[model samples]
Target: MAFTVSANFAISADGKISSDPQRPSGWTSSQDHKRLLELRRNADAIIVGRGTLCADNMSLTVPDQTPQPLRCVVSRKGNFNGNEKIFHSHGGDIHLLVTNAISCDFERDSVTLHFANLTDFIETLHRDHGVKHIHCEGGGMLLRALLDYDLLDTLHLTWAAHTLFGGTNAPTISGLDDGIFFSSRHFSLVEMIESGAEGELFLTYQRNDAAK
Candidate 1:
C-alpha cells in the first residue's frame, strides 16, 4: 500500500491511445520508445492488463539490464496466452493475478500465479516481494481501475500530435465510455517538455496529496 504506482501512456492528439482498439501503439517516435524503456528501467515491477500484453506482443523485459523488473499480468479470469511474448522472454519473476475464481494453471518455473483482488495483490507485492515502485504500461481499463482504487501515484504521458484517431468510440486515457463514474482524481503537472521536431509532448504528473 505504501509503494508508488506510475502509469505510462502515449496518446494521440484526440486523446486516443490507439487508432484501433486492438492495434498496437507503435505510432510514437523512436524517442518515445526510448523513454518507455527508461521508465521500465526504474521500476521494481511492471504491470499490464492481458489485453495490452496480447495487443502489443510485449516482452516486458528491460534490455541489457541485470535482474529485470518483475513481469506482472492481470486478468479478470486469468485467460492469459502462454504463447504471448512475455512468457518466453527473459525477465524477472512473472506474477499472474487473477481477480476471479477461475483457475489458471499456467505451469512454468518462472511463473507464479495468484488469485486475488487487485488491492490484495498489490499489497502482497509490496509486503512480500519488496516492490517499492511499480510501473504500469496500460491499455486504458486497467489504468481506470487503479485510479478508482486511488492507487496511482504518478503519470507519464506522451502526446503525439502527428497522428489522429478520430472516432466517437475511440478510447481515451481512462477508457471510461461506459457511463460508470468515479470521483475526480486530481494530479499536478510536475514536468513538461516540448519536442516540436517530433510533434510530441512529454508530460509527467504527480497525484495531488490534498485530493487524497
Candidate 2:
C-alpha cells in the first residue's frame, strides 16, 4: 500500500509557521480554525514533529467524529513527556516514530513506538495501520526532511497577512539546512480560496505528479 502525506499549516505574512518568540497557531483567523478541523476530518491519521507536539501541546482529538484518526509523533531523538494530551486522549491510537540514531527510554501502553527509517515508518502506516491519507502538522524540521526526500505529496496552507513574527531563526513550513535543496519536489496549486476581507488565503497544493 502507498500512503500519501499532506501537510497543513497557517502562517503569518512573514512566512513563519508560528511566532518567532514561541506562539501557537491560534493567532490565525477563525476561518483557519474551521479549515484545520476540516482537514483533520478528512485524514486517516495526523502527524506532527516532536517539536510541534511540545511547542503547541496539541489535543489531537476530533470532536463528534467517528473513528478518529491515529495521532502520530516523530522524533529524531525520541525525547517526549508523557503528559501530552495525545497520550491521554480517550480514543484513537498514539504512535511515536523514533529514528535509529537515538535511544528512547520512554514507553507506555497508550503509545506504540516504531524504531525505523522514515521510509519504513511511513510504509508501516499504510501496511499495518491502513492509513491511506496522512495529514502532517509540522514544526518545520520534520516537514523539511519529508520534502527533502520527496515524501510530501500535498500542502494545505493558510496565509494570514495580519500577523508577523519576525526573527531570522524563525522556521517556515520547511526547515532545511542552508545548502540543501530538492528542486524536483515542486507543488502546483490545487485550489485557492480567499477568506473574507482579512487579506487571508486558503491554498491547496499537490505535487506536480499528483495534481491531476
Candidate 3:
C-alpha cells in the first residue's frame, strides 16, 4: 500500500515562512487559514513539528466535531509540556513520536507516546494506523528533513504578496540546499486563490510517477 504525503504552507512573495519567532501573525492570510482548516477536515491525520506546536500553542483539534483525526507531533527531544492545551483537553486522540533517547512517564488514555526512528514513524502511521492521507503543516526544519528523505509526494503552497522579518536566522519553506540536481516534471496548477484584498496564489504540485 502506498501512502500520500502532502505539504501545505503559506509563504510571503519573498519566500519567508514566518515573520516572528513567538507568533506567525501576518504570514498566513485569513482566507488561507479557512482553506487550511478545510484541508485539515479532509485529512486523516495532520502532522506538525514540535517547534510549530510550541510556538503556536495549538490544541490541534477541530471544533464541534466528533471522532477527530489523530494529532501527531514529531519531536526528537520530546520536551513539550504535557499540560499544554493539546494534551490536557480530551477532544481527540493525541500521538507523540519521539526518538528512543527521550523518556516520558506521563500516563493518559487519550494520549500515546511512541518511540521510533523518523522513517519508521512514518511507516507505522501508514501501515498500522490506517492513515491514507497525511498533511504536514510545518516549521522549515521539518520540511527540510522530509524533503531530504524524499518523503513528500505533493506540495500545496500559498504565496502572499506581503513581506516581513527577513534575516540570516529566519527560515523558508524550502531550506538551504547546495544546488543538488534532481529531476522535475511539470505539475498542473490547481487554483489561483486570492486572499481577500490582497491576491495570494494557491498552487499545488504532484510528483511525476516516472520520477518516483
Candidate 4:
C-alpha cells in the first residue's frame, strides 16, 4: 500500500515472453527498450527478479537522470555472484531483499541487504528509503507473487505479432502454480499505442480498484 507497483513485459502473439529454454528477450524492438528506459527514468526504484538478473545480466541504468533510481533484486535465497554487472554498472545504490526464510548472510558495504517478506519490504522502501513508485521488469514468478499479494497497481504489455515463441517451458507475466489466484483482480485498458503497420501493440492496463 505504500508504493504504486507496476510491472512491464513484452510478449509474442502466442503469449510467450521467452522462447524455448528461457531464452533472453533480445528480439523485442528498440521501441520497447526506449519505453523501458523511460519508465526507469521516472521511477524512484527499479526491481527485477533474481532469475531475470541471471538470465539477462541487467544493469537497471537510468542514464542522464539525476539522483538515479535504486536498483533492487529480490531473491528467496539471497544467492548471487559478486561479479555480476548489476553490482558494477549502476550509479545508484543497489539493495538486495532476501526473505527471512533465508539465513544466508548477504551484507556488504557495496550493497544494502534487507530481510523481509514482500509486504514488509514495500513498507520499508516507502518509510525508510522514501520510495513512492516502483517499476518491475519481470521474469514471471515475481509478477505472480505481487499479483497474488494484491500489490500490483498497473501493468504495461506489448503484443508483437511477427514473433511466435511457442514452447511449453516459456513463461508469460503470471505463471502461477495455482491457476486463477488473481481471479478477483480486475484491470481496464488505460492506453494503447499501435505501432504503424507492424502489428505491434503497446498497451497499459490499470487495476480497477477505485471502481469497485
Candidate 5:
C-alpha cells in the first residue's frame, strides 16, 4: 500500500498559482494564510520544493504562538544554502531529501539529510520519520511528480480573487493530463465553497479508489 499524501496551495480565480516574478502579493489572502497555518499545525510534516525554499528563503516555521511542523525539502541538485533560515538553529526540525548523487554537509540543531531514491522517498518518510500526514506546499514540478505517481490522496486549494502572471512560466493546479483524470475517473471533488476571506474559494478533492 502506498502512503497517503495531501497537497495544499493557493491560486487565483484565473487559475494562476503564482504571480509575476517581480511581485507575489495578493496571490494568497490573509484568511488563506490563517487556514494554511492551521493545516500546518495539524500536519506531521510540511514538504516543499527546493525552488520554494530558495526563492522564498522560507523558514517553514509557523508563528511563535503556533506549534511548528517538521520541514522537508525535495531537491535533486542539492543546491541550497546550509545556513538559510530554514536550516538555522532557531528553526524547528528540518529534513532534506535529495538524490543519491548530491552531497552536502548541513549541521544544525535539528537537521537531518537523507539521500534516497525518489520513488521510495514517501515510503521512507512514513516508515522511518513517522510522517503519517504530509502537506505538500509545492512548486509545480514536485506536485506534478506526486500527481503522476498517484501519491497525493487529497488536495486543498484556496482560490484568490486576483489575477497574476498569465504567461507560460506560472504554475497552475491542473496540468495537461490532470484535468482528464480528475474530471472523469481518478479523483472526485469532496468540497467547494467561497470562503469568508475576500473572494477566496476553498476547494477540496479526494482520490477515487475505484478508478485506481
Candidate 6:
C-alpha cells in the first residue's frame, strides 16, 4: 500500500522559512509550536532533512506520547556526528536515508538505509515498514524534493505575518535557491483559521488531483 505524505512549515510574511540558512525558527509563537506537536500525533513517521535536524537540534520525539513515530532523516552524504539530539533522545527507531554513495561511522543503534534518491526511500518506507502516514517538518530543500516528486498529499502552514525574513537568499517552502518544479502542482484549501491575537493564519491544503 502507498503511504500518505503531509508537511508543516512556519513561513514568514516575506515567504521565508528563516532569515539565515542555519538559523532555527525560534520566532514562531508557542501556539505554532503546539500545532507542530498536534500534527506529529497523527503521523506514523516523521521525516526531516539533516539540515533541519541539526539547525533545530530536534529530538523528533513527541512529548508524553505513546507509540512514538519513527524519526527519519535524509542527507546527501551521511556525515552526521553522533552528537545530534535525536541520537540521545528516547524516541522511535531512527532511520537515516543517505541518498549518495558514502560510508558513515557512528556508534549508535540508528539504522542507515542507502537509496539512490528520496523517492526510492519514501517508497521503501511504505513497502517495508508499514508506514501509512508520513509527516515532514522541513528546512526547505527536503520539501522541494517532495514537491518535485509530486508526492505531498497535504500541506499545513502557519503563516506568521508579524515577522519578515527579507533576504533574496532566504528560502520559502521550496528552498533557498531559485528553481521551479517540473510542473505546477495545485492544491485546494481544506481549512483556514485566523489567529488574530497571534497575527498568524493557519492553513491546510489538500492536493488537487483534478487540477494538476
**What are the clash counts of all predictions, listed in order?**
0, 0, 0, 0, 0, 0
Deviation from native of the Cα of residue 172 in model 1, angstroms? 1.7
Q: Give each model a TM-score.
A: 0.94, 0.91, 0.85, 0.92, 0.82, 0.94
The digit string of per-residue lDDT tens for model 4 on 22-111 reads: 457763887887778887887888998888877777888887888988888899989877776788785678878887465665555679
Stretches off by above 4 angstroms in model 4 are 20-22, 100-102, 210-212
In Å, residue 81's CA in model 4 sits off its true spot by 1.3
The C-alpha lDDT values of all candidates are 0.86, 0.81, 0.72, 0.81, 0.70, 0.86
Which runs of model 5 end up more than 4 angstroms from their true locations? Answer: 20-27, 64-67, 89-91, 100-102, 105-109, 174-185, 210-212
How many backbone collisions does model 6 have? 0
Candidate 4: the clashing residue pairs are none
- For model 1, residues 1-212, the per-residue Cα lDDT tens digits are 47899999998878898866687877399879989999999999999998889989988999999988999999898876579999888888999999986586667777889989998999999999999999999978788888878889999999898888878666677874745655678889999988878988999999996232
Model 5, 1-212: lDDT tens per residue?
Answer: 43567888787766766754223433366778787777677677888878766666677777774446778898886777676667663545788888755577654556677788655777777788787888887766578777766677888888776555476656675432334444332668889978673877888888776322
Better of 5 and 6 by TM-score: 6
Query: What's the CA RMSD of model 1 in angstroms?
Result: 1.6
Query: Tens digits of per-residue lDDT for model 6 on 1-212?
Result: 36899999999989999887787876388889889999999999999999999989999999998999999999888888888899989998888988886566644656655655888787777888889999999979999988888888999999998999998877789997757666788999999988878989999999987222
User: TM-score of predicted model 4?
Assistant: 0.92
Residue 179's lDDT in candidate 2:
53
Whole-model lDDT, candidate 6?
Answer: 0.86
Worst 10 residues of 5 by lDDT: 176-185
Tens-digit lDDT track of model 3 for 110-184: 678888876778888888888888788887767766776677777788877665557655667755343442644
